[model samples]
Target chain A: MKKLYSTKYFKNKNNKHAEASLKKRLRFKKNKKKRNKIQNARTKPQKRVVNNKNKHFDYFKSKAPGNFSFLTHPIEVIEFISTLKSHFDKKRKVFILMNKIKSIDYSAIVILLSIMVKFKEKKVEFNGDFPSDDNINNILIASGFFQTLFKISFKTRERYNIGTHNAIHTHAWKDVDAELGANIMDNVSKMILGHKVIYKGLQRSLVELMQNSFNHATPTKEGEKHWWLSVNVNEKQKIASFSFIDYGVGIFESLNSKKEGSKFFNWKILMNLFSSENNADVLRKILNGDLHKTVTGKHYRGKGLPGIKEAMDRNLISNLHIITNNVFANVGLDKYELLPNNFEGTFVYFEINAQTSSTPWTELQ
Target chain B: MDRITVKIARDFSRTPGPRYIKEGKWSGEQFRTEKFYSIFDDAIKNDKIVVVDLDGTLGYGTSFLEEIFGGLIREHHLDYNQILNHLELISNEEPYLMTDIFAYLKDAHEESLVDNH
Candidate 1:
C-alpha cells in the first residue's frame, strides 16, 4: 500500500480503526487551547463598572405630540406624563423634546407645571426646549410655565383670538387658603359677571377641595404637599375655567389604603359584586354619594366629592370634569370613562359662565 | 328664656377656613375656641336661645360647618337634642346649609352614642 491512511483506508477494517484514532489525536491537538479558554471564561466573574459618570450616562428622551391636551388628546397626554414617572423614580435626567408640539391646552399646561414642581421636589434633572412654533412658545410664556420653571420672564405676547382665550391665573398652597380662594372667586365673578358676587357653591367647593388636598393628598399627616390651582378667564366666551390639581395618592388609592377593613371596604365589596370595580365605576359611586353614605360614622369625612357633585347639580358650575388615577369623569354629563393611563393625581375642571348664578354681594351683610 | 345672636361673619370670620386651627387661619376650631364656644356656654347656662347667622361670609365649608355644629356634641359633649332645641341657624343666602348643619349634628350625636357604648 502507498500509505497506511491512503484511498484504500476503508479496505481493511483493522487499518481503518487505527486511522480513526490518529484523526482524533490530530483534531484534539489542533484545538486544545480553545477548549481551555472557554472553560476559564465560564468560571470567571465579570467586573461591574461603578464610575459616577455611568450613573448619569443614560437619558430617557420623550417627545411631545402635536396636540398635548387632556381635553383634545387625553390618552396621548396622559401616556406622555406617565413616562416621566420612571425618570423621577430612577433619578435620571430626562430630555423632553417639545419641538413637535403645535398646541397645548390649559389642562395640559397645568399638568406640565405640576410635573415640573414634582421634579423639583424630587431633585430630578430634566431639560426641555421651547417649541419652534412661536405661537406655542408664546402660550408657554403667557401661561407662566417658563416664568415658573426657569424664572425667565418674556415680554407678554399678544394673546391668540382662539376659541375660549385664556387669561391664566395660577396659585399654589400647602394648606387651606379660604381667603385666597375667595379672592379668586371674587376676581372670577367680576371677570364674568361684571360685578362682585360671592358664588357660595363655588367657594364651598374650593374650600372642600383644599381641605381634601391638605388632609388626604399625601401619606404624610397633613400639609406636607402643595395643591395647585389655575383659573383661566375667557372674557370672549364669558366662561371662567378653573383647574385644581394635587399630586398625591389619588382618590381610589387613598380610600383603599386608609379604609382597609372599615365600612368603606365593606361598601367597596358590595359595589364590586353589583358591578365591575374599575376605577371609573368606583369614582361614579363616590360622586353619587354611595360610598360617602357608608362612612357615616365619621360624618365629617367623605363629603367633598358629593358636595362638588351637588354644586354641579344645582347649576352652580358647569362642565364638571375630574381626572384622578385612571378615571376621567364628566360629572355634569354623567359620563365616567376608564382611562388607559393613570394621572397620578386629582384634576378638577369646571366652568362658570354668564348664565351661572351667584349670591349678590349686596344680598349679604 | 333670654336670647342672644352670633353673626359668624361679624363675630368670627368672614372667610371661614378648614376644620382645625393647625390647618390654616380662621379655622372652625379656632372660631369655636375663641368665639362661638364661650357664647354657646353662656347660652346653655343662662337658658338663652342662640341664633347663628350663617351668611355674609364668602361661604362655609362642610368641615367648618361640621366642626362648629357637630363639635358641640362630639367635642364639648353637649346634648344634641338640647343643641337642636336652643340653636337657631339662619342661612338666607344658602338655605340648604341649614339643612346640612342639622344633619351633621344628628350624625355626630349618633357617632357619640356608638362611641359611648
Candidate 2:
C-alpha cells in the first residue's frame, strides 16, 4: 500500500514546514526528570538496608566446594537452596562454609550470591569466613557482591574506579538501579569499541534481562532473587565475552508452566506439529518474536527475548548464546542443543568481536 | 501550512530512553509517557500541527515510543485518527521508525476497541 504522494516527493514542502516549525516546537520533556532527580538529591537520604551486627549465623558446616567449575556438575543449584530452606526457616543464625571451596566460576558466584540474598531477606543473622584461596576471595570482593548486598563501603577496592581494566562484574543481591549494563558499556567501550558509551539495542536487551530476573524469576525460597552479570575482555583475541545468570524459571518453563503452555502444545498436537519440539526450538522461537501466538490470549508479552535476534539481525551483536533448562543454543556457533539434564535456570553468554564491531553503535538511539 | 516542532535532543537527554532509575542520575529521564504527552496535549489544545524530531537523540526504545505515541490514545483518551491528523514525526534518519510508531498506534487502537492489549 504505497502512497502516491511520498514525503520525499514533498521534500520542498516539508523543508518549508520544518523551517517554520523550528522555533515553535518546545524542548519540553528533556530536562524534567533530571531536575526532579537533582531536587531530590539535595536532601540526604538514609541507607537502604537494616544491617544486624549482633546476630551471626553459620551457613554451612562442611567445606563448600561450590565454584563455577563445581557448579557445572549435573546437580541443580536451586535444589541446593531447597535443602537449606528448612534449616533457614528454623533458625535466625545462618553461616555459609566457603573454606572447602577449591574452585569457582561466574555461575557459582551467581548461585552463591542469589542464595545468600534469599537468606538475608529472611532476617537470619549471616556471616562467613572468606574462602582460603586469595584469588577467589579477591574476585568475589571486587565483584561488589558483599558491598552491594550488605551496604558496606569498601573505598580501598579498585571496584570504585572505572578505568582499571576491561572486565566488568556486578552481583545484585538486592534490588538496584539500572546501573550494571550502562556501567559495563561505559567502562569497556573505550578499550573495546573506542567509545565510552553503550549501544541502545544492547542496553535495552540488558535492561530487559535485569528486569526479567527480578520481575518473574521467583526464588526457590520466597525472599531471594538475584542476577549476576560479567563482561570479560580478551585484548589479544580482540573479543569481549559476557555472562549473565539468573536462577529462576527458564523461558519455556515459565511460559509452559502456565496452563497456556499445555494448551499451546495441545493445539500443536492437533495440528500435527511439535513432534520434535524441545527447549532449543522453543528458545529459538522465543528469540525470533514468533511466540506471540501462544501469548496473544494472555497479553502482548514476550517482546524482550526476540530483541537478541533483532540486535543480531541488525548486526548489532554476534555470537549470541544461551542455556536455559535443558537446551543450549548459540546463534553464531550454529548450535542449538538439547542436553540430557535440565540446567534449572538460565545462563547466557555472547561475544563482541572488536574488529567486526568497532564502530560506535547508534542503532538504538 | 506550517507545523510545530519539538527538538528532543536540544531540550531532553540526548540519549532519551527509559525512566527506571530515580537517584544520583546524570542523564535526563524525560522519556516518560506523561511527560511527553503533556507537551503533546499543549500543542493539541492549541490546534497546532506538530512535528516531533526523532533525530539527534541517542536512540528511541520501542517501549518509549509505544508508551508516548500509543499512550496518547490510551491514557490521554485521544482518538488515534485525530492525533495522526495533527501529529507528524520527523524520523528522516530512520524511516522505519515511522512504521514502528504506527504499529504501536495500531496495537493501541485495537486495545482501545476491545481492551485486549
Candidate 3:
C-alpha cells in the first residue's frame, strides 16, 4: 500500500510542488532584475538643487551654525545626529555648512555638542563656520562651551567685531568678500577631525534636564520665549561635557506653588524627590509601563533622573552632576553623592568615552 | 539541533491611556494587558526561534519586564553573571534594550540556551 501511494500520489504531489517552486523562482528572478535596474538608476547623477526655496527658508529660519535648525527638539536632535552619521564616510572631508545661520538657542547648542562628540567618536573629520557675534559668543559661553569645548582666539573675536559687525554697521561687510570667503573649509575640516568627543552624554542629559525645567520648573509668560544649550567633546581623551541655561523663572519660583502648603516643597525635599533611590525606583516602575500617560497627568513620570542613572550604568558615561535650586546630586561609581550648593535652575555635567577604535561592549564582552 | 532564539514579551494592558471617569469614577479601557506576555510565553514553549526586538516591543518604562523576566530568571536559577553577559551582548547589538526590560529577557534566553546545550 505504501509503495502504491508513493508511485501514484507522491509523484504527482512532487511534480506539482516542483512546478510551483519553478514559477516562484522565475518570478523572484524577474523581480531581482527589476530591483537591480531601479537601484542602478538611483546611483545615476540626479539633478539636485543646491539652494531650493525650502532650503533657503531652513537656512534663514533660525540661528546657530551647521544644521542647528535641525535641533529644535531633543528627539529631533538625536535623529539628526543618527542620520548625519551616514555622511561620515571617513574618507572625504565632511563639512557642516553653517554660513547662513544667524543665532541659536541653548537647546540647539547642546545638540551640536552631541553631534560633535559622535563625530569624534567615529573618527570623522568635521568642518564648518558659524556666525561670530557677541550674542552668539555669550550664548556659547553661558552654555559652558566657550573654553571647555572649543578653542577661540581673542584675535578672532576682534577680527569678527571689526570685520563682520563693523561691515554690517557701515555697509562695508560686502566689501571683504575675499576675507569672508577665505578657505574656512580647511580649518573646519582640521578642527572637526582634531575635535574630541567630550561631554556628549552630559550635554544630552543637560538638554533633557533643562527641558524638564521648562516643562515643570519654569513659568512661561504670555509670549516670552527662552532658549538654553551646551556642547563639548574630547576625541583623544574620549571625554565630553555639556551644560544648558535658561532665562525663565528658576526652580524655586516654579516649585513655590507646591511649597506653599506641603512640607515636600523645600529644597531638601525637592532634592530627595529628584534623587532619592526609593523615589527613583518608583518613578522607574511607573515609566516602565507607559510614557504618554506618565508625562500627561499630575502623576508626573519622574524617571528622567532615574533614566539618567540607568544610562550611566549602561553606557560609557562615568559621572552625572546636577545642581538645581541650591541642591546638588553627584552620581559617580554607581553611587549618589548629595551636596549643598548655591545655584539657580538646573545645571548638569557628565563624562563619557568616545573611542571609535575600542570594541563596543556587546562585541567585546 | 535547533538554533537558540530569544523572545521578548510586553504587557500592554498595564499601559495606562487617557483616563475616563464613568459616573464620576476613574475607569480604564479594555487595554491590552496579558496578550504580550502570552504571545511570548507561547512562542517560547513551542520552541520557535525568538528574537525580541526590545525597541519594537517595549518603550518608556520597564517594570512589566522586571516582573516577567525577573521571575523567569529566578525560576530557572540561571547564573547571574552568565545572564548579564548575554544581556550585554544583545544590548550592544540593539541599544534599545538599555532603555527597556527586553535586556533581561535576552539574559534569560542565554541561560536557557546554555542549560539546553
How close is every model to the real structure, measured as TM-score? 0.81, 0.64, 0.31
Best by TM-score: 1
Best by DockQ: 1
lDDT of 3 by residue, B1-117 (tens): 133333331323212111111101111111212333343344455544334433222122232344345444545444444344333214443355454454455545564666578
Q: Give the TM-score of candidate 3.
A: 0.31
Model 3 misplaced stretches (Cα beyond 4 Å): A1-211, A219-227, A247-302, A313-315, A333-342, A354-365, B1-52, B55-117
List per-model TM-scores for chain B: 0.96, 0.78, 0.34
DockQ comparisons of all candidates to the true complex: 0.40, 0.05, 0.01
Ranking by DockQ: 1, 2, 3
How accurate locally, in lDDT, is each candidate? 0.76, 0.56, 0.38
lDDT of 1: 0.76
- In the range A1-365, model 2's lDDT, one tens digit per residue, is 35634657677787888876764554334467676676566533111111221233234442345554422542444345445555576765555566556776655555555555555556555555566577887667755555545654322221222112444454453232344555566666666666764455455456556555654466333214556666666556656666677768776666554444343444443434476776677677667655654545433332456655666666556667777777777766656777666655677666566643322445433
lDDT of 3 by residue, A33-132 (tens): 9987765665222212232222443221222333343222333333444345446543333445444556555345544544444344445554444344
TM-score-superior candidate, 1 or 3? 1
Interface RMSD of the predictions, in order shown? 2.5, 5.9, 19.0
